[model samples]
Target: MEDILRQAVGVLRSMWRFRWWGLALTWVVGAAAAVVIYTMPDRYESTARVYVDTQSVLRPLMSGLAVQPNLDQQIAILSRTLITRPNVEKLINMADLNLEVTSGPQREQLVGELMSGLRIGGTGRDNLFTLAYRDGDPKRAQRVVQALMSLFVESGLVSKRQDTDTARRFIEEQIRNYEEKLTAAENRLKDFRLRNMALLDAGGRDYVGQLAAVSAQLEQARLELREAINSRDATQRQLQGEDPVLLPQMPNAAGVSIPEIDGRIDAMRKTLDALLQRYTESHPDVIGTRRVIEDLEAQKLKEIEMRREAGPGQFGSLNANPVYQQLKLVLSETEARIASLQARVGSHEARLAELRASAELLPKIDAELAQLNRDYDVHKRNYETLVQRRESANISVEMGATSGIAEFRVIDPPSLPLKPAAPNRALLMLAASVAAIGAGAALTFLISQLRPSFADGRSLREVTGLPVLGTVSLLGDPRREASERRGRYAFAGGVAGYAGAVAVVTAALKMLQG
Candidate 1:
């Protein structure tokens, strides 16, 4: 600790020995630094605050019907894009900030400088944002800030309107496309129906039902025809018999003995029953069968009355015999029934043939119809969705036009600054004083190192590594010593005077600036 203290004391003494040179260097450097600081151009800043209103009175009423703009997101986008080249150019033109820039590179450099000087920020946890610009001229700074504010607000509104219009136009285009598709589908379906109306009408019965009905009717008709032919043959044979002229003992009117007529009535009744199983009573075949049965029964009753009134064997011819006549009538009726049944069978066969022909085209028609229906359904759904969106977009546009739902209000207007915000003179001067002192100390140390001298015996021993044996003292004339002392005082006075002059000049400059 003692050694360190001694070293510090030695340095202070060496500095004091060259105090005049230190003072001169200090004053010169400090004055030069002060001048350079004062000559720097002053920069002024202007700022404006804006508040965004995100809520509106009509918002609740139009909640699901209209789109709501995101104010914070819009503000973030504006902050990033506000200083783009095009916007900067617009600002430059509006503010007349020519900056004497004519070439492309020069203009680009100017834009960059302007962007660097401009600042946009959002206040913490609020809907308020600030726009600020820095420039050498206070008025220009204020003008730039005002221009930024106007551009930001106008751009936001214009962007929102453009988005709304775009949405509406897109929906309209989709609706037109879907409308054309739906119309085309409908036309195709109509044409298909018109081309195959017959098949479509029969489609209601289904293939299985039609086939079963036609088959059942064809089998029944064949059975009835066969029975009728047999009955006709049997009646003719009975009429050819040798005893055909003789009548059987006549029974009561209620108990007629006409086997052929009775058999015909029974067959008709069986047919009616079979038909009833498959068809309603109102069906044409059922009605026809019932009528035939009633007629046969009436004929049998008439024959019974004829047999009761005729005497036994009075009519000798087979045609006059009541039983024979009855048999003949039955035979003719059976033959007619056979003919009618043959015609029905033929008609049924023809209908089956026609159904088979139509069935061949069903698969192809179904495929095409299914595709058309699918397309129509898809287009219909898309058209409906687009229509709803279009209505919503229209509502949003109307709301934007009428209401200030996402509006920017200039809460704090830009103010023209009277004083420069940069080039702090007091701070600059203090820094200059510190730098000057450092430089003065460095110069003093350099001078002392160049003119090396031992301050004490230990220093001499350290440099030479030799022993110091004796000390010598020089005696001088009194008058010469006194003259040297006076010269030293004069040198001190000169250095003080120079330092005082520099201080006075710096003070004068500061006063003039004020």
Candidate 2:
């Protein structure tokens, strides 16, 4: 450790023997660094902060249970939109940024530089954002910020107005279509009713009762007519030349009593009983029995003739022939009348069925058409209302700027900075100092490596590794030594250069302080 320390001290001492050169270089470098820093132009910076909070207009559409839009995403979108070419150009035009001297690649370079200076960033957890720009003038930065904010508001409102107009137009078109359909349906129903005229008034129990009564009267008339015709035919038959029936007497000892063969046999039996009681079988009374039987048989042939003469009242009760004949004639007429009435009833029933079927369907169709018409009207009204609002929106008065609470608010406007943010003077000077120290150390190392000759005995011995056999001393007088120091060119020049470097450093320090 001691040896290492001794070696380090010796090296430092050897290096410091050329300390004058290091001092001169330090002065020269420091002066140059100060001069460059002083000549550089001053730059100005402006910073603005904005808070982007949530607003209803920018909020996402949602149902009761739906998730809301992410505020961070919305802010990101707004930021990107603001940085677009149109927005940037608008701000440039509105603010009248002084870029007249800038042209071609230089102008483009300036714009790029400006873009780099303009910072847009937001905090992750907070809604606050920072916007900053650096320029030669501070007021231009403030104007740019104001213009951008105004343009953003205008663009958003315009988008909303367009959407509203589209919605109104779509609704109106749909309403018109529905109205046409409703009108057609109503017209069809009216036409159907007009064509089937009778169906409208034909209904209720009166029509049914009348139809039944007519049928009953007709039936009774048909029954009476039939009986009258039967009576008239029977009378005609009796008047014709037909053989008279003979009565069958009770069987005597000589003749068989065939009552079925003789229709008048009962009449003959009564006569025979009267005769047999007055005389014996051989008596003249028996001959009178045969005559009486024959007379009864002849009378039986005219019974239908007698029935015809009885007229409308001769028969007993309901069975009287004259009354029955009259009743039968009335009955036949009633039956014919009933046949006509029955046909009418059938016709009425068919018409009623047709009318009923038509009536049943008409109401259902009418009801459906009515509902359609109502819906069409409601939609039409809504469409008209929207159209009016949209038309109003197109006017300047309606599109006028509105001042309200906003999601994004500017906290600080941009302003120009007095000093250039680039090319830091302090850093440049520090670098220059470091470079001077390095050069000084490098020169010393080079001289050491070159093994330069020194007047000192130990160094001369160390370099050549040869013995110094003798030493020469006091060869010159005092006056000559003094003259040598004054006239020596190498020593005089090196000292002058060192003094000039020191004077330059002192002047630079004074200028920097001023």
Candidate 3:
């Protein structure tokens, strides 16, 4: 510790020995540094505070019905994009910045400078954001901050409105496309039904039920025909042993009565006879009635021959016996029913064949129909979702126009700053003082090293590695001492002049700042 102290004392003494030079250099360097610092441009800062109000009076009413933008995210984005090239250019024009460059690169550099000077920050865990700008001019700094605030608010509204419009247009386009698809699907379903109309069971009766009904009717017809043939043969056998004139009358079958047919034939003959009485045989009504009577007579004769063949009996005037005629009528009716049932059976068979063929196509048709239905359902769901979203978008647009939700409000407007924020004068002066002192000390040390003089016996012993003898004192010369005194005065005068010059520069700087 003592050694360190002694070394420090030695350095101080050496500095003091060259005190005039040290003082002159210290004042000159300090004054020069102070002037340079004062000449630097002062930067004024202006700031504005913006509050994001995400609460609205209509929010409760439109909670689920309107699109709500993320306020924090939007604010974050605005903070980043607020100082873009276009916005910066607008700020420069509005504030009339003192940039005189006309070239694109120079303009870009100016914009970059503006951006670098701009600062945007958000308060912790709050909806408040701050916009700050620094510039040489206080008013220009305020104007820049004001412009940024306006851009932040306006850009948010514009972006929201544009998004709503785009959403509505996209939904409308999707709805139109789905509508066409739905129409086509409906038409295909209709055509499919129409094309397979015969194969489809309108009454919901399955194929098995239809086939059973037709077979049952066919079997009943066959039973009735068999009964009628047996009755006809019995009647024919009974007629062979009896006289034709004395044959007994018989009751008509349930569904067939010879008497009724005979009455119809008689009525037609009488009508024809009456027509012949009124007009010539070649008259239209007369010819038509005669043709009808002839057709009935021919039908009766055919029936008689059918009965005779059915029994294998000799029939003499079989039509004259009412029993045989009745049996023959029943036989003819049964045969007609059998023929009708056979035709119906054939039709049923064709229908069954058609059903089988349609059944073969059912799986493929069902698969296709299912796919169409699935597509229709998907499109329908999507269309509905789009419609819902479109409604929300419309509501959001209306809410944006009427409400303050997701909006920025400038709580504190930018003000003209009175003091410079940058080029801290006091700190710069202090640093200059430190640097000047360091420089003076360095020059003193350098001069001492160049002179190569020993300060004490210890330094001499260190240099020569020899023991020191008693020190010698030299007598002073008056003339030399007088010259040294004059040199001291000159050194003092030079230091005073340098100090006065520094004071003058400082006073001028203060006047310029004022």
Residue 73, candidate 2: Cα error in Å is 2.8
lDDT of 2 at 507: 54
Q: After TM-score superposition, what is the CA distance of residue 16 in candidate 2 from its true location, in Å?
A: 2.7
Whole-model alpha-carbon lDDT for candidate 2: 0.52
Deviation from truth (RMSD, Å), model 1: 11.7
TM-scores of the candidates are: 0.54, 0.38, 0.54
Please give the lDDT score for candidate 3.
0.70
Cα lDDT tens digits, model 2, 1-514, are: 9858755666666665665565566556656766776676545556667766555541233222222334466556666566655556565666666455366676566456655656666685576767666565556656665565555555544544565467557756765665675566557646754664444333322333434544564555445445545654564454343333433332332232222214334434654576578656654435544554565456543543453366424311222244434434344333333333344345445555554556555455445545655665665666576555445533322322242213456676554455456455555556666676577666775665565435456556776899877666767689998876665565457556645644565456444433
Which 10 successive residues of model 1 have the least lDDT summed? 312-321
RMSD of 2: 25.4
* TM-score pick, better of 1 and 2: 1
Question: Which prediction has more favorable lDDT, 1 or 2?
Answer: 1
TM-score of model 1 relative to the true fold?
0.54
Estimate candidate 3's RMSD in Å. 13.2
Stretches of model 3 off by over 4 angstroms after superposition: 1-32, 98-106, 187-353, 429-514
Error of 2 at 18 (Å): 3.4
Clashing pairs in 1: none
Judging by lDDT against the true structure, name the best candidate.
Answer: 1
Q: Could you tell which candidate, 1 or 3, scores higher by lDDT?
A: 1
Error of 3 at 92 (Å): 2.4
